[model samples]
Target: MSALLRKIMNFGPAFFAIGYTIGTGSVTSMIVAGSTYGMQLLWVLFLSCLFSGALIYAYGNFAIVTGQTALYSFKKHLRFGKPIALMIIVGVTFGQWNSLIGILGISSNIIFEMISLYVPSAAEHKYEIVLAIAVVIIGTMYSILLIGKYSLFEKILVMFVSCMGISFVLSLLVVHPMPAEVAAGFIPKIPEIAGGKMMVAAFVGTTMAAATFLSRPLFIQGKGWTMKNRAQQRKDAIVAAVLVFVISGSVMAVAHGALYHEGKRITHVLDMVNALEPIAGKAALTVFFFGTLAAGLSSVFPCMLIAPLLIEDYRSGQLDTNSKQFRIITGFAALLALAIPIFGFNPVKGQILTQVFNVFVLPLVIVGILFIINNRKLMKDYAAGKTLNIILGFALLFAIAISVNGVIALAGQF
Candidate 1:
């Protein structure tokens, strides 16, 4: 392979991370924040992504140095590692499965809504149409994973991620948001307004999710990366973080420009799409929907893969990504999620719960990572230095604060 091809191939894990991070939940959360607060929470997105990158690096380093995925590392190293690993598995699986259901619902809704734009009658039987769309999507995802090896799968995800990123940026440009307002959004300030704190916590949970950290080790292992490729791993983390910022930031910009101060509510993906029509024109709306669809699909691919892959990690066994067992496990998750669209649940609440669960369970992973990474016996000379610990410490504190606030918010709601 040429140097360029080789360089691109090395970044597969990062692309997977990007595909997973910038999915429907990120888009929805960004829209929620931007439409409600008019970019006042851009600082939250910025800080969350920044901190997430650091945490990703920290997690990736753990995998590289030890040559073990995160769950396996946790199980082998800490005194309570086994129970902690099981807890993480339960937490991540529950949270992601919930979000995955919502993601499928959102994607089907967007595709069907677009179809309904031309064929109005289709909207009349929305439920059946959504199920049909869901079947096609879920089936397609299963076939891809069943047929392709890791490299090919990574390439497909990278392509969609690129498409989503470009489409969002182009749509943001069409809206022509004010530079001063965009600049002002970067100055950190607490959201004192109603829904402000919840938005901050949501952004943090979505952007800096525990699943992102837990899943990285699997990707790193899949890429055949080791300590010898440490620099490359760090580069990939930076790329993933940058992609998260650009794609999610663009979504927020468009939301702020088109929906903010418009006396409109963005209750769903379709609502946001329709809201943008009067402001950014039909062309922009089309581009935004395509971006949203791509984002949703890209994320769905990994969300389905997480549980089965984690099972492999825990067992310390390699399951063929294309095996029937693997596909069955993945497809079962998709099947369960079909209930969300059929039996209705509030997507916004589902999204918030997804992020909160991730944030609430994050400290477990963080502590396990810190313990193993700092273990001189396990990490050898690769034990984490003081500087890395300080960074991880800050991340832990942020997770704790967000978790506390999220619990409080949810309690108040009750």
Candidate 2:
């Protein structure tokens, strides 16, 4: 490839990473975090984004250097026996299953809300039809991936991210949050609650899945990055991290200003969009819907693709794009994505569950990545620096605390 083309290709993995983060679950999670806690949990978002980015960089660099995906590297280089690898595989697979369900559920809800605007008569019983539509859309996404072209998917994801970014930023502008309050949100402070414990748990759970840090290495590997191109990979990872932070922060700012300030509560993405309609007018509402739709669809593509790759890697030691197991797992995931809407589960609840699952899974994945990236045999000169290790170690601890608290909160709700 020419120099210019190669430079552009370096962006490929970042776009893929964005898709992993910006999906249906992500948008809904951000909305929940913003509406429920206002800017109180904004620090978690920053911490999650920074920590995840660091891990992504480490694992991406590892993959590029060693020419192996994170999972494969873990199996080959880690002292842990096959049992540990099996456990990781099983855990990751289950996590993906929950993620798929949640993504499908939220995406279906978005579609249902968007369509309900046109046909108010069907608003009450449209969920079944919405689920069917979601399935068809997921199938279309799968067909696009079956062709095995990253550029096409990357371009589409970039476009979606752009639209979503513009919509949320515009919404934030319309709402115009108090600069002081917004600034305060950036400060690390826990929210005040009667007991403080539940509030802390919700705060942690809500921000836990800021993005899928574990999947970044696999994405980087798929892009064919190598150690010789470590600089390029670092650039790509940085780009992705910044995008995630900006987009998520924009959503929170808009919600904090538009919804929380007005004492408005949002249980769905449409609620967030509808809240903007009065202030920003119908055009703004339309933009919000379009942005959200794009976010949902862009996420569907990666969830369908990467979840299956993780599953297949767990079963076999390699990612054979052509293998029957790979195709079957992808097909199954796509089907589940479609089925989520059909079941008529509350999208908000499903999104919360997804975040909670990520909270639980994140610590394990972080520990694994930290271990592998720091392994002398695997990283050699590139082993995680002391500062990075300390940061990651604290991040893992935070994730564990959040995961436990989230589970307790969920149990309380039940």
Candidate 3:
């Protein structure tokens, strides 16, 4: 392949990774971060991006060296045996289920709003049709992935991410957040917001997926990456990390400039769009809706694929990315995409719950990855360096702290 073509091909996995991160929780989390903290939490975004990028490089490199996914590596290196592996497997399954719920919830709201616009009179009875449309869209996504051609899906996602970028950029230009506030956000200070507790929880929760998704290990196994693939993997991680930071930052800027300044808080993705109409016009509302839909659907595609792959790897004792069983699992997960719309839960709430689960799952995986990556036997000459070890150690502590705080907050809500 030509040098230019290789660079383009390399973009595929990174795009897929970012698409996965920009899900329902991401939309709400970024908006909440902006509305509640304004630019104060901008530093969190930058740090999380760096943390996620480092993890991707570490985990992706591990997968290449050990010839296993993160999950498989955990089982092998930890020697927790079948019982422990089974428990982790169950946790992952539930995580995937929650992800499906969050995705469908966001997509359903967008469709609901779209319908209300065209047939305002029928708005009262649109839930049934909205459910149907959600099913059709999700089913089509499943069919495309079942064909096992990720290239097409990646292309579509890149286009969607591009559209989302454009929408946010346009909003940013209109809102024009003060340079001082923007700079403050990048400095990392907690603000005295109404939902300070929840905002903190949400910030950690939102970035939880960033670290965990990059740690999947499946990407490395599927791509047949090795130690020799380190440079490519690093490049891929950089692309994914940069895209995540820019897109997320843009969303924060839009929300801070447009909604926060008005003292109008938004709890839902639709609310964010609705808030934009007065400032940026109805067309801006449309653009916001499209961005939310694109982010939700694009993330759903990867979740569907990952769910089955995780299961198949456990049952076969190997990571076979192309197995028929894996494909079937992806199809089954697609069916779940329909159920969330049919149930019609609040996307904002669902996103919070999903993110909480993601944060809950992070500690175990981080511990496992840290142990495995540092194992001299497994990594040979590629073991974690001093700087990498220090970073991973801090991440582990941060994950635990966030998990504990998240559980307490969740329990208090109950």
Please list the C-alpha lDDT of all candidates, in the order they appear: 0.81, 0.67, 0.71
Q: List the candidates ranked by TM-score, beginning with the highest.
A: 1, 3, 2
lDDT of 1 by residue, 210-255 (tens): 7888888888877788778999999989988888998899999888
What are the candidates' C-alpha RMSDs?
2.1, 3.1, 2.7
Q: List the residue pairs that clash in candidate 3.
A: 39-185, 40-185
The alpha-carbon deviation from the true structure for residue 27 of candidate 2, after best TM-score superposition, in angstroms, is 1.5
Tens digits of per-residue lDDT for model 3 on 2-74? Answer: 7865566666667667877777678778887777668787776777677777777777778777776666556
The C-alpha stretches of model 2 lying farther than 4 A from their native spots are: 1-9, 118-125, 192-211, 315-317
Specify the highest-TM-score model's number: 1
Candidate number with greatest lDDT: 1
> Number of clashing residue pairs in every model?
0, 1, 2
Sequence-dependent TM-score of model 3: 0.90
Query: What are the TM-scores, per candidate, against the unseen true structure?
Result: 0.94, 0.89, 0.90
Q: What is the lDDT ranking, best to worst? A: 1, 3, 2
Lowest lDDT 10-mer window, candidate 2?
202-211
